[model samples]
Target chain A: MSTFYFIAFLSIFFSILVISAKNPVHSILYLILTFFTFTIHYILLNAQFLAIVNFIVYMGAILVLFLYTLMLINLNKESEPVKPFMVKIAGVFGGGILAVALASSLKLVAASNPVILKNPDLGLVKNLGKVLFNEFLLPFEVSSVLLLSAMVGAVLLATKDPKTA
Target chain B: MESLTNTIHAVPLNHYILLSAIIFSIGVVGVLIRRNAIVIFMSVELMLNAVNLLLTAFSVYRGDASGQVFVFFIMALAAAEVAVGLAIIVMIYRNTNSIDINVLNRLKW
Candidate 1:
C-alpha cells in the first residue's frame, strides 16, 4: 500500500520533470523514468501483460523514437521557443481550475461500490488474448489497418518531395 | 493470487481516479504552456497514459480483462499517433527549420 503511494509520487515527480526539463534530451530521459513508474504501477495492479507491453512499447519504442528525433533535429536552446510569462501563468491557472472542477464534481457523486478483484488471473496474457481474439476481433483487426495507414502516412510525410521543394 | 486482490483492496479506487485526474491536468497544462511541438506531443502521450492507468484500475477492480484489451488498442493508437505526429514535426522542421507550433500558425511558408 505504501509502495503504491511512493511509486505514484515518483511517477508524478518524474512527469513533472519531463515537461519542466530545460533540454529536450533531459526531458526524454525523464519521460522514460516516468513511464518506468507507470510500468511498476501496472505490476502492482497485477496486470502482468500490460506492464511488459508498456515497458517495451512506451519506454523502449516510443520514447527512444522521441530521443532519436530530438537528436536528429538538434534543437539548440536558442531555438527553443519561449512563450510569454503571462501565457504560462494562464495555462497553469486554467489547468488548476479544470482539476478543481473535475474533483469537485466527482466528489458530488455517490461513492462507488468498493472494488473487489474477482479474478486474480484476469490480467494474465492468456485471458487477455482470449478476450481480445474472441470479443474484440473486429476492433483488433481494424487497429492493424490503423497502424498500416499511420505507417504509410508517416513515410509519405517524411520522404523528401522534389516536386514540392 | 490472494495478493492481487489484497493489493487492490490496499488502495481505494477514489485515489486512483484523483491521481489520474491530476496527471491528466498536468498534461493539459503542458499542452497549454509549452511552445515546442514535440513537447506538446509528449504531453498528449501523458494524457493517454493517465487514461490507460484509470482503465487498468477499473479492469482490475471489476475483474474484467476487456478494459486491458481496450488499453492495448489505445496503446496501438498512441503509437500510430506518435509515428504520424513526429513525421509531421520532422517535415515542419525540414521546411521551416523550426518545430514550434506558433511558427505554423500562418499555414504557409
Candidate 2:
C-alpha cells in the first residue's frame, strides 16, 4: 500500500513536470518518467503483460518518436511563444473545475467490495494471451488493419513532391 | 503473489479513481495552457494514460480480462495516433516553419 502511494505520488509529480517544464525536450523526458510510473501501476494491478507492453510501446516507441520530432524541429523556449496570462489563468481554472467535478462524482459511486482472489493470474502473459486470442481475435485483426492504414496515411502525409516543394 | 494482491486491495479502489481524476485534470490543464503542438499532444497522451489506469483498476476490482483487453486496444490506438499526428505536425512545420497551432488559424475562410 505504501508502495502504491509512493509510486502514485511520483507519477503525479512527473506528470506536473511534463507540463510545467519550459523545454520541450525536458517535457518529453518527464513524460517518459510518467510512463514509467504508469508501468509500475500496471504491475501493482497485477497486469504484468500490460506493464511490459506499456514500457515498450510508450517509453520505447511513442515517446522516442516525440523526442525525435522535437529534436528534428529544434524548438526552444524562444521559439515557443508564451500564452497570455489570462489564457493561462483560464486554463488552470478550467482544469481545476474539471478535477473537482470528477472527484465529486467519484464520491457518489457506491463502493463495491469485490472478492479478492488469492494469486490472481489474469495479468500473466499466458492468461492475457489466451483471452486476447480467443475472445478478441476480431479486434486484434482490426487493430492490425488500423496500424497499417495509419502507416500508409503517415507516409502519404509526410511525402512531398520535389516539383511542388 | 497473494501478499501483493492483499497489499493492493488494502488501498481502496476510490483512491485509485481519485488519483486518476487528478492526473486527468492535470493533462487537461496542460492541453489548455501549452502553446506548443507537441506539448499539447503529450497532454493528450497523459489523458489517455489516466483513463487506462482507471480501466485497469476497475478490471482488477471486477476480475475481468476484458478491461485489460481494452487497454491493449487503447495502446494500439495511441501508437497509431502519435505516428500519424506527428507526421502531420512535421508537415505543418515544413509549410509554416513553426509548430504553434495558433499560427495555423489562417483557414478562417
Per-residue error for A114 in candidate 2, Å, reads: 7.2
Model 1 CAPRI quality = medium
DockQ, 0 to 1 scale, candidate 1: 0.74
lDDT of 1 by residue, A70-112 (tens): 8888787465878999999999999999989888887888886
Q: Residue-wise lDDT of candidate 2 within B1-109, one digit each (tens)?
A: 7666776867788888888999999999999999899999999999999999999888888888888999999999999999999999999989888998899889687
Q: Candidate 2 on A112-163: residue-level lDDT in tens?
A: 4643533499888888899899999999999999999999999998888587
Error of 1 at A72 (Å): 0.8
Docking quality tier of candidate 2? medium
- Worst ten in a row by lDDT for model 2 chain A: A111-120
Model 2 misplaced stretches (Cα beyond 4 Å): A112-119
Which candidate number would show the highest lDDT if scored against the true structure? Answer: 2
Which pairs of residues collide in model 2?
Answer: none
Residue ranges of candidate 1 with Cα displaced over 4 Å = A112-114, B1-5
